[model samples]
Target chain A: MNDFLFRLFRNGETRLHELNYLFWECTTRCNLHCRHCGSDCTMGSRDKDMPLEDFLGALDTIPESHRPKGFTVVLTGGEPLLRPDITTIGREIKKRGFGWSMVSNGYFYDEKMHHLLMGAGMGALTISLDGLEDSHDWMRGHAGSFQRTVRAIKTASAQRGLNFDVVTCVNKRNIRELEEIHSTLESLGTPQWRLFTIIPIGRAASDPDMILSKEEMTRLMEFIALKRKNPSGKMVTTFSCEGYLGKWESQVRDTPFFCHAGINIASVLIDGRINACPNIDRDAFSEGNIYSDNFYEVWMNGFKRFRDRDWAKRGICTQCKQFRNCLGGGMHNWHGACEEPLTCHYSLLNAE
Target chain B: MKFFRNILKGAALTTALFVFQACYGTGPDFDPGIEMSFHVVSKQTGEAIPDITIMTRGGSESKWFEVGKTDSQGFAKIYGLDYKHNGIDFKFEGKGVTPKDTLINDFSKNFHEIRL
Candidate 1:
């Protein structure tokens, strides 16, 4: 309950407008090249690590108030652990009473990471999975990356303190293996499988083929529905794409709204700027730089300006009933790369 | 009407427990559709920015569409309308606003506010 949130709720405009989650892209340098990476993350020039002090100092700027629940700081990167100080960073963030979660390709994982993160007080560890092995390795552009990730997850989960989950980006190359991936996680005692609906944003936006069509996404949703009815009894499947559809979100409370991007969750780039959405064009959608500006002011004024726009009448999103449920999925295609609104394909497909 | 509303935690992604039963062609009815208005104001100040023009198609193909300007209350109302003004695009030409041209979306919201 920071001051910004207190004012927001006080004004009675508290419709999921509290910044609860923070996404810190610790580094853009990753060892494996995944085809569906929204950040277009890679090694070499992309490897600009955030100074540990800059990241930690930015935390102090977060307005402290009576929080209704715990705060979460999600550490992501080209593979966050590539930098040795990740554990230290994680430890510092946890010390602030913030829940800590990190996403990694898991190539650098060893027993040391498990112990380090566990000691740092990890809330969960999300590992990237494309398919089982062939599908995952193909998407990752590495031969044995699957073996590496599987081993990493196994080692980390062995410590009861560390929770393991799989984050899969569903694209043409690996849509068929959703079930197989789910079962593997279930077998591993891993609970959740978050399937990200690949939107054409970063490198993928240039290559339209990487983006899934409405039919493809709808079929995937149908598959998810089927899997939900039957008892996988182990792994749970959730879709990032579900946020775009017109429906009540399972995870969202009371409201039909989808994301709290500027409202609640915000992404901090390596340069210390706060972005509206993690997947948005980083340079364009930036609300403000935390180093020079106030995080709360930037988020309230700079970031949340999108919420003021008339999304219900915005192009393809206008006619659909679900338009209100999603605020055009966080103004995603503002770059104008796509021909139509991202969810229009579904509206057309569903209409058919 | 500001009709509202991702980080997945562990313990299984039980979406079944949390399902979105969304059906197309069915949602809130944007009644008395033609009667629409938008308020333009400074997001930083929360006060009105006057003299901004609001251009519109008024949901018709004919260029005999619609246009109006904001009153002292920062409010602008479309003059002539009978059916739904779904295609209305409010091009607010002002000095300090970010969105030069904002499409006036579904009147389901009825009263729209454009904050600069």
Candidate 2:
């Protein structure tokens, strides 16, 4: 059967069951310009930062029935700490009966911010740590960032119930330094660690050195598999759920490959546009605007493109035997410029 | 007679399995997209201005992409430009007016109404 007919008869991944996670792009301003930053956030970003009330007002638009129990709003941005009112935002989010967390580079985060945020109902944090000093500084395009981030990690990890996870963006430059980075994280008393390879977009799209080749990708997977198998420190390490990795799926990550963008996860961009995932291209897949449309209505009925996978089965995806299992990789992996999916773990492994 | 009965049962079982698989099949998951719109008006008379060109850039040295131009109603919009810099510079120019520049430093609001 054809793609449309098949989808019509079958219950596919396009269905929105419940809202478990929501990412709010609070701001687009960051202190550093990372080489592989998908959002290309810089210190001089011109995007206006949303006020605490704006996000709260947008949250009110999502009816309680649409969200699952204990739903959390994840605040992500150029750097969430750039906003002076982050604590107030967290407090307001808590007032609405939802938990809150943040994704940060750990540059400005310290003991004081952690205390303030925790008091304001911050439950978790995911901080980026690309590599050891030199490699990390180079990737971030800033000096002394690694030291500041490491200090923040230590502070966060020392606290109980902070649920800190140190995420590293693996690239050609840092691929060799994974072992050292892991050791550094373990020493910092990190509770969890995640590994993700760069998607070729933004600054990364222009820099060929930022993306890993098939062989290098295998090495990264093998390294993760080894870490998972070996008795490491107290830290629980897993590869990020960025794409399907065939045999490495169960070994590297806690669960099998799944792109939870629209179904269970959604994000509001700085410009008031709602999308399934933060990394997804806003031009092609925006569901609706928080300013003009009701959030619950958009969540329920507006993700037509997100819920359908029939169109993604073109190009190299059609040739892969794992297409049915991988579903053309993650939506973020689709390079609109090239009109083909990039970084297929299945295809990469098969190439070997 | 017994052999014919077995063949019918086998075919029925195959059809049932196919139907079950068809209804409960799995595939790839969710995605996203967004856009920002703008409106320009006269500062002196509060009249909607037309033919205004809105050029956007991430920073001082970043390349500029013409997001959109104001129409007869002074409305324009932008989406899917591959630039990722958060800080943006919106420069407005028209046939017979002083060029103006505005800064939206973060991903805050989508709709902007500017009076030139």
Against the true structure, whose TM-score is highest? 2
**Per-residue lDDT of model 2, residues B1-116, tens digit only:** 32532353268532321210000011110111124567888889888899897776522245453545687999765442222245567788898778888877555577888888
Cα-based lDDT at residue A75, candidate 1: 80
lDDT of 1 by residue, A61-122 (tens): 77667232436677877778888787667657755656666777888876555544543545
DockQ value of candidate 1: 0.01
**Of all true interface contacts, what fraction is found in model 2?**
0.00
lDDT for each residue of candidate 2 in A37-66, tens digit (9 for 90 to 100): 888898778899977777777788788765
Error of model 1, residue A300, in angstroms: 3.9
Q: Which candidate is the best by lDDT?
A: 2
Worst 10 residues of 1 chain A by lDDT: A247-256
Quick one: how many clashes does candidate 1 have? 11
